[model samples]
Target: MSTAGIGLGLTGFGVFFSFLGIILFFDKGLLAIGNILFISGVIMTIGIKSSLQFFMKPSNFKGTISFGIGFFFVIIGWPVIGMAAEAYGSLILFSGFWPTLSVFVQKTPVIGWVFQQPFIRSFLGYRGKRAPV
Candidate 1:
């Protein structure tokens, strides 16, 4: 109902699309769609935050850095390596939003727990409590 709600929705789609893109990296059409959705989620969720307070945290710093490097490789590096980087970067980025993202994923009747596993959270670089509202 609010902008934040929309942002969260975009983030969900972003995750889904990124996964799809990774799956169909060889298919230009689906891969393009995936790339678009992934970027849209990041922009909607964080682009509007002009305040330094929104991005100055250590986790956010790590996430953005990972995302930036991954994006660069995905755009112009070797195919196989690029895809891997994209996945890793996305994991970190998604982890950065774990608190909020989990709220949506947890609503699912099945498989939510899988997504919330400690190893996945740690791998994605999720640390400390959920991000500030």
Candidate 2:
């Protein structure tokens, strides 16, 4: 299999392990393992140079810093707080992909039906736009 495919599998496992860690009372070891796996998987998926460039982009500095600090905290045995910071950093870092994700969700077959529900649609739809006067 290709490196990207292997990386994707690793990423999936990393996410699974992270969730498992959360479920198991925020076990630091599991969380740390998950973080390592996730980071390595990302590097493998995108290659070293591109991953460095992506993280070093000026617009991504804040997320990168927060993520780095959170990783440090996790290493230092502060799993909960570190995960919180990491979550925020992830949100900031990945916010740009939400639109693409939404599109994908809408296009999928079974999952798309759930998101197409009226209530779900309303929740996902735009709000608070004013008409031209």
Candidate 3:
């Protein structure tokens, strides 16, 4: 699939899990499942970024390891740490100003780059032989 396709899929997963989590709040077991799925979504995006980074720069061990650690943390923390982390982030942007700014920034190309900086241009290995640099 194309990069945009992968990114959009990840985004959909994140949204689905988050919404499910909200809907399941009243039911303890379902809530836990939703939380786990949410964590999985986060891990999925991190893995995609890491893979892309690997393709871009084979020697970028730091970036690879960073994503690996994030993946591990999200997996290990699912239903607890993951849920709390999401909650914290949501709370942080709960303000009217922050959400508005976030939307505005996302709409601006430069600002969007700022948000995607960590993963932007990171490579997903090409299907065939590597091209000459």
Candidate 4:
């Protein structure tokens, strides 16, 4: 399999483990593992150079710093706070991709139906805007 495919699997697992850790009363070990896997997966998927460039961009500084801080907090056993920080950082860092994600979700068979609902669409502020790739 290709590196990107492997990376995607790892990323999926990382997200799963992270959520599982949260569900299991904020387990520190699980969160740490999840964080490590997630970062490595991203690097592998995008390549080191692109990953560095993406993270080091001036516009992404705040998100990068926040994410770094969150990772540090997780390492120090502050799982709850670390997760909270990471969530905020993720939102900021990935805001640009939200439109693309929305489009994808809307195109899916099952999820699309739910996403098309008036209440859900309004809540998510999804006005069917197509993002430029």
Candidate 5:
């Protein structure tokens, strides 16, 4: 599960970076390079999953919901994905955005400060909230 989380996170970051790069850069040559890199990153990520296992896997409610969301995102984000691929190869690995964004929000200033607030931190802590044995 942890490995899957890491893989998904890397994929999300790759895709996000790729999108930012292509949109920010106008050089055709550079864009071509970014696209190639993005494709490579995607291929690497996908390689982590076994094809037979993927098809043969069973789905629970969580899996079904996740798959639905993913399918919807892919359908809606197709154009954005192209631009992302043209910008940064890392964008190819974008499934980890939620956790990455969470960590980023905690570390980066402005938005970061919001997530890092004392009250929020205390509320999120589980150390003292467990039920007595």
Candidate 6:
């Protein structure tokens, strides 16, 4: 299976667990499982750009940062912020997927506006731009 395929599959698992987490909020174990899967799915979907084609160089940097923040928040038992952080982190990570997504979906919606920033551009791995020297 392709990376995109794997990423999407993980995304499904993540969503499932996230709903499970919500339903079983009082149960720490199930909640933890849900939280972990959601974060993992987002990160994997982001494709860890730096690792892609070692010679190509990654244009993004903050995916790991947001991901860490989310992970930490979850560890500290802050369910709300942790999930929010994870969500933002995943969106941060999704920059790379934007170009391909654009081809399929046409409008990028709100993220289309956020995509204007230089930082967000990097996060998207500089999709459509020439490689740096």
Identify the candidate with maximal TM-score. 4
Please give, for residues 50-126, the per-residue lDDT of candidate 5 as tens digits: 53344235533344334334333343544344443322322323333545555656777787676666666556452
What range of 10 consecutive residues in model 6 has the weakest lDDT sum? 50-59
| Tens-digit lDDT string for candidate 2 (6-84) | 8888888888888998999989888888988898889889899999998999988899999888888988999999999
41-82 in candidate 6: lDDT tens per residue?
A: 555665666335321334444655675677677667876777
Candidate 5 residue runs with Cα over 4 Å from true position: 1-25, 45-96, 104-133
Model 4 Cα lDDT, one tens digit per residue, 1-133:
9999988888888998898999999999999889888988898898999999999999888999999999899899999899999998898898989978877887899988887787777778745543233
Who wins the lDDT comparison? 4
For model 6, the superposed segments whose C-alpha errors exceed 4 Å read: 1-8, 22-31, 38-59, 105-133
Give the TM-score (vs. native) of candidate 2.
Answer: 0.89
lDDT of 5: 0.46
Task: List pairs with backbone clashes in candidate 3.
Answer: 52-123
| lDDT pick, better of 3 and 6 | 6
Task: Rank the models by lDDT, top first.
Answer: 4, 2, 6, 1, 3, 5
Give the TM-score comparing model 1 with the true structure, all chains together. Answer: 0.52
Against the reference, the lDDT scores of all candidates come to 0.59, 0.83, 0.48, 0.87, 0.46, 0.61
- Lowest summed lDDT over 10 consecutive residues: which window, candidate 5? 86-95
Residues 1-133, model 3: lDDT tens digits: 7545565566566557556755655333444444455445544655756645533464544444443443344455444454555455444323324545544654677766654343432332222332223
Error of 2 at 70 (Å): 1.1
Runs in model 3 with CA error above 4 Å?
2-11, 48-86, 89-101, 104-133
> How does residue 18 of candidate 5 score in lDDT?
43
> What's the true lDDT of residue 2 in model 5?
54
Cα misplacement distance, residue 20 of candidate 6 (Å): 3.4
Could you give the candidate ranking by TM-score, starting with the highest?
4, 2, 1, 6, 3, 5
TM-score each candidate: 0.52, 0.89, 0.32, 0.92, 0.32, 0.49
